[model samples]
Target: MKKFIHEDFLLETDYAKELYHDYAKGQPIIDYHSHLPPNELAEDKNFENITQIWIEGDHYKWRAMRALGVPEKFITGKATDAEKFQKWAQTVPYTMRNPLYHWTHLELSRYFGIDELLTPESAEDIYAQCNSHLKKPSFSTRNLVSKMNVEVVCTTDDPLDNLSHHITLAESDCPVKVLPTFRPDGLINIEKVDFTDYISTLSKITGITITDLASLGEAAKKRVAYFHENGCRLSDHGLIHAYGYDYTEAEINKILSNRFAEKSISEKEIRQYKSAVLHLLGQLYAEKNWVMQLHLGPIRDTNKAILTKIGINAGVDSIGDYPQAEQLANFLNRLNNSGSLPKTILYNSNPSDNELFATMAGNFTGEEIKGKVQFGAAWWFLDQKDGIKDQLDAVSNMGLLSCSVGMLTDSRSFLSFPRHEYYRRVLCNILGNDLKDGLLPHDMKWIGKIVQDITYNNAKEFFQFPSLVENLSLKR
Candidate 1:
């Protein structure tokens, strides 16, 4: 019997097969954004079992298990690792159409060399096999990343982080360049209850007094310089939507004073304050020549019961139908008008906003940069095959797909690098089908170069990380 995930998996035509195998398969991955723990990579930690690596902290699988009526003890509570693996195996058969089904099997096959379908019947042997593989010295975190041919990994970090682990990795003999991405969502989210506390933490870290917006911007600017000195070339922001409300400096300072005094501010004031902070940070990013990434449109933590019990990122966030266009344009235009619009990548969690994001990206594409404002890869709920294709179609139809920078994991798992491969296959299949239908000319070399650029070259150029450039030159 034919294996479900063969070499030509997801490649439906001969052109697709050739494109994937000949051009896309050999490219290195640049996971420019991920939630992977830098400490694990720095320590070269090895997992005790497959469940530790695969199931723990993987909310995607947890959501599926919950939908299948699996007990909380097995999902996230004190159930033994073996018991948790059993529950996940049982839930696998029911996840036929979900991306989890593909991701589970792909991770198993790629990492453990296990090709058998994950089901209750084959669960025990597969579990044992994965655990055995995890015990190998070659399965350490650093080794695992190197094995996947990853050139660079930019981990998400807060402005408050000292980046000791990144410093360690930089001074070590580790092959992959683990860089830090400056994420100031904590600083930008003034509406959170912990906003004052976060400001205190930032003030301590930067040795600045945060009495108002000016001091706060000064503290944040110091952090940006600190992060840049520590090898950061990117900044990330997670918001329901961009804040572009108009506010004078006095108004923002008053809003800050009220918030710091434990006074409740109106929604209008909240928007103005967030806009001011975001604009200040955007200027800092431009000054530092950093890439800015905005992950937008998700209404996070909707289930208050789950949120209260499990806290944030508890698999309760859903796509939001927020008004994105007007505010997003205003935010970008504000930065542009001030001559501080940095290279930006926009990721939309809602699939309905595909063209909206792609075209919005087009509106800010100048400044002698190729794809300066990218309509980033399909993100969150939209990382699957159909979503990937939809994003590609939107970019190709509304913008220049050839200039696209390609896929990212946006994941927390070290074993998720195969997503890049999955994306490549889907990309080749799309182009191949276009060729087959006579939509594209029958030119292999040019098309193949386009495939390679989207897979690797575009990102390499787009990010312009010093370590990546130095490493590529060394290879040459």
Candidate 2:
């Protein structure tokens, strides 16, 4: 068998190796969506050890360790850092066939130069080596980002966020463009338990009294303007599915008033309110020429007991099976009819909706824009190799895969940058196999251009971030 993680790890053929190394590998990253904290990058924090950097805030690993019967303390509880690393080391070999196995080894090899398979036997030595490297200034958060050759990273932020850290990074001339993406899920999800508290937070941020739907709209408008002023050109939403309700302003106002007064609203009213807010936000995004991202189909916080112990983003969520196509089409059509549909990306956590989302995106292509509407890269549970192939096949069959802006980490870890590399390899292998199998012609130049675009070019062209470094390939 081939050596593990050699130069051509996932490349099964000569064509795949050529496409990856010569074209896809060197492309600078444009991480258009991620949950990386702006404050850490601003401060250039140096992680103390492997566990601190790898395990902390990484729910993927937590989920795997839990499956291996690793206890709460070693995963997310009050265990020593070394203890946590040990437990994860013990769990790594069991992750074979899971994307976690590849991701773990990739992170290790790329970041720490450790190519040996991780096991309980090698855990201590590997941990010590990574910790030694972590102590260096070159491994600081900013340097880590630079080392990965990432050109831009758009961090997810709330409407009420002050963006003070982003401002700090911008003023200091940090090379990587750490921009903000407006994520207003809490503001739109009025049925959430903390909806009133969130509204109060928004009111304080905007200095607006949000007693009615009009005032709430005013608050959101101000926040959107503020985000734009801070160099934000993207807005994101997480939804069970898209909503498109035709409700009068009076109805929305009543729903807002009821929620504000500690009164209950019906399920239908909740849908109406969410639809109204989404439409208004879509209009704002279009007016400002911002890219809107919709991350659909996640059923979050299913295990209430687990949530109480570890809180949100701690690996208790699963894919949702909500009806998507009709509402999604209506939502986009509403914006398109108003001549205010901005560039959009639709990401479905559930793989079964791949074709539905792909065709839905194809329906709204803009006259003046190339790939104005896109089926986003496979996300969350769908980021694995098989899932990547599924998404690519669907998009190629139903939409324009060439114009697609490619992968984003959608992660909270710095080491997760290798995920882009993983995607590039998978993409190159898929295209190369097609060539060898007589599916595609032997035109390497044309295929290489496509690989480069998906790896970096599409995102650079698609997003309108003000200070995005001129695309390096274009600069040549």
Q: What lDDT tens digits, residue by residue, belong to model 1 across residues 1-476? A: 99888999999999999999999999999999999999999999999999999999899999999999998899988999999999999999999989999989889999999999999999999999999999998999999999999999999998888888988888778889999999988897788999999999988988899998899989999988888887789999999899888999999989989999999999999899989999999999999989999999999888899889888878888899998999999999999998999999999999989999999999986657999999999999999999999999999999999999999999888899999999999999999999999999999899999999999999999887875435321100
lDDT of each: 0.92, 0.91
The reply for model 2, stretches above 4 Å from the true place, is 1-3, 469-476
**Candidate 2 structure, TM-score to reference:** 0.97
Worst window of 10 by summed lDDT in candidate 1: 467-476
TM-score of each: 0.98, 0.97
31-121 in candidate 2: lDDT tens per residue?
Answer: 9999999999999999999898899999999999999899999999999999999999999999999999999999899999999889999
Clashes of 2: 0
* Model 2, position 176: C-alpha lDDT score: 91
Could you tell me the C-alpha RMSD of candidate 2 in Å? 3.2
